[model samples]
Target: MQLKGKRVLITGGTRGIGRCMIQELIDQGVSHIGIIARDKKSLKELSEGYPEVKFIRIAGDVANIDILREAAARIEDKWGYLDVLINNAGIVSAGPTEELLDEDIYDQVAVNYTAILLLTKYCIPLLKNAEESAILNISSGLGLIGMPFYSVYGSTKAAVRQFSDSMRRELAPFNISVTCSFPTATDTDMMQKFEGVEMDTPEYVAKKSIEGLVNKELHVIFGGEQRIKDVEMNFSDPKKFDAQVAKTYDQFKQSSEGHKAM
Candidate 1:
């Protein structure tokens, strides 16, 4: 859908891909935008930085249902219709699943999965009212294949992938498009804990996201060469895929053992 003068709402709009998406939307002539994130100050900064646009900042943790519902209500009250809903907020708790903190598990599921579902549920009417509308879900490449030390994150993204697929079919009759993005490891604060992993800049993801949405592409997979390889491996050979994942686990175990020895 063309972004000119579109009413767009993006979760986690302060940083990473969300920030870049906001900028890209501005470039595409989006006038009214709503941002949902945890920090009020950051929201203010973004709003001030974009004086040419109308930015509505609803500051709250997306993991809280009340907070998300409140934000949705504000959007409904203000515009009464939504042209785009970008479900981009997510958290990552990398490492062995058993070793993850209890709070981490809860936050991952709530912020990444549940929040998106409920927010979409709340915004469906607004979306349907628009002449042309779309919902963009930010998933991950890891969601396409189970990987070592990223089980929880991967699972949540996988859920998003499935959700997007189902929503696409369901919303087809309503003329609402659903697009899911599967970006590889992106150079965001979320990926900072990983010591030596190469990542795509958030700019790349932002560019691809807008392009995919305009084209109404079903899935936008970033990370050129490695992304293609991963998709091919998983789709073509399940045994090889499993073995590759097993090797990654072995390497991670060896690394942990060496760290303990040191």
Candidate 2:
């Protein structure tokens, strides 16, 4: 589970927590990284910023199946195997589900859920080729506790959590570990629209998540003790959780208004 000398592939590694993770990986001694991001300029900048690291930059949208396939194919041709796969790219468009745009919903699903599934499918062979490998999936706190005004985003993240669990067991025989991270209200470009709220720094979240992957931990959950208590209450006493949600319904709706990052 050591990151030293590992060949890692990550999505959206050019910005926010993903970018911080790239730094964490380098700090942990990873030298070869394959990054999938939408901006060609950012990818180029990343390569330039870390001259010592060998970066395989694939500039394109993760939502595209072709882009995902291309990334896997490129990695196979160049590295033959992959030691780690980090599914970190994500998009969010929030509001009341009834008022949300259809296109935005589709985009969120394609980017956050389908891309993870397809990219992981394509990389399994490459991962198996390695002596030992690992997968880290970035989910959300909302995934654990289904909150209002974020149905689609939360569902996609919840899917990631499920996929991580299933893959952890399915890939056990192959010596591939799977880790899922649930981060809440992170202070990143993704949450720029929200103001006056306490949040976890992206650096802290990235550091912890990378540590979780290296330690082979199954889950790296943010949001502290309260989040855990809420998750427990949501699962064991749905009606009780509903009443809590009802209390903050207005705040949730207002925060979600025009909150989007894609």
Candidate 3:
């Protein structure tokens, strides 16, 4: 969808890819941009920087259905409708499944999957009102191929990918496009926590996302083309894919440790 003068709502817009996308949308002449994030201080700072843009900063946890409902109400009250909804809030916790805490698993699922489900349900009415609407879901290469130590995170993203696909079919009658963006390691704070991982910049991912929206692409894979190919190849054999991912995870962990020593 053309972003010019569109009303967009981005969740988790405090930092990383969300922040980059918000700025990019503004640069594209999107006038009404609503950002939902837990960091009030950072939202305040962002509002101060872009005083001309219509920056609606609602500080709340996306995991809470009540908070999401409230945010949707505010959006409907302010703009009446939204042209784009970017579900970018996500969290990753690494550990062996046996050792992974239940709370961590729940939090990851809540923020990454459940929250998106709730937000989309609430926003569908608003999106239906727009002349052309789009739902952009931030998934990952891991969503297709499960990586060891990141199984929980990967599973959540996998759900997002499938959810977006289903929603796309369901919302097609309304002309509300759904774009599932599968990005490889991006140079955001999340990737920084992994240290030596090679990653694309948030700007790069944001650009690809915007391009996908403009072209009305249903699926977008950014960063490593090889990784996307691998995902496609493994779609038929998940067990084999998991084994390969385990090997890659070991190598990545070793590289991260080596970098830390330097």
Candidate 4:
């Protein structure tokens, strides 16, 4: 669907991909934009930067039911319909699943998986009113192939990918498109927590996402050509893929141990 004059709502719109997409959408002439995030300061900053554009800023955590419901109510009250819903808010808690705290698992699942599900359900009514609408779920490359040291985080993202698949098929009758993005390490705060990995810029990921949406691509892989090839290979040969991942994990472990010794 064309973004010009479209009403869009993006969760976690203060930073990273969400923030970049907000700016991109404005540049493309979206008529109404709503931002749901926890940072009032960032929202104010954006609002100031784009003084002529009116962005509905609802400051709250997307994981909370009350906050989500209130945001939904405000959106419905203001525009009565949304042309795009971007489920871009997610939390990643890396490290071994065995060492994961209960809170880590719960919070990751809440923000990454549950929040998207709830927000999508809440906005379906409003979405139905639009001429042609879209829902974009930002998953991760880890979701496509599980690796060592990130089991909990990977599981949550995997859930998101699966949900997007099912939701896309279910919502097809309503003329609403659902697109799931599988991006590799992105240069966001979340990636900062994971040391020594190459990352993609949020702007690049946001641009690719919009391009995929416009093209109606079901699965938008945002990790350049090599990662895309790896994903395809994993899908084509599960046993060989698992062995390769195991070998890589062993090398990473040895490297970490050597660093600690130093």
Candidate 3 lDDT tens digits, 1-262: 6788899988988798888998888899888888888888998998788877887788988998888998889999999998999999888877667777788889999999999999999999999999999999999887877766677888999999999999999999999999999988888877655766568899989888878877889989865677766777688777777677677776765543311100
Q: Tell me the TM-score of model 4.
A: 0.93
Poorly placed runs, candidate 2 (over 4 Å): none
- Candidate no. 1 TM-score: 0.93
* Model 4: colliding residue pairs: none
Error of 3 at 13 (Å): 1.0
Q: Global lDDT for candidate 2?
A: 0.94
Error of 1 at 30 (Å): 0.4
Over 195-258, each residue of candidate 1 has an lDDT whose tens digit, in order, gives: 5567789998999998898789999988787768978989999789888777777666543331
lDDT of 4 by residue, 1-262 (tens): 7888888889988888888888888888886888888888988887788876768888888889888888789989999898999999888766556766788778888888899999999999999998899999999988988777667777888999999999999999999999999888788876654556677899999989988877788999866787877888888988888888877786554432311100
Model 3 lDDT, full chain set: 0.84
Report clashes for each candidate as comma-separated counts.
0, 0, 0, 0
TM-score of each: 0.93, 0.99, 0.93, 0.93
Off by over 4 Å in 1: 250-262
Whole-model lDDT values for every prediction: 0.87, 0.94, 0.84, 0.83
Native-vs-model 4 lDDT?
0.83
User: How close to the true structure is residue 52 of candidate 3, measured as C-alpha lDDT?
Assistant: 77
TM-score of 3: 0.93
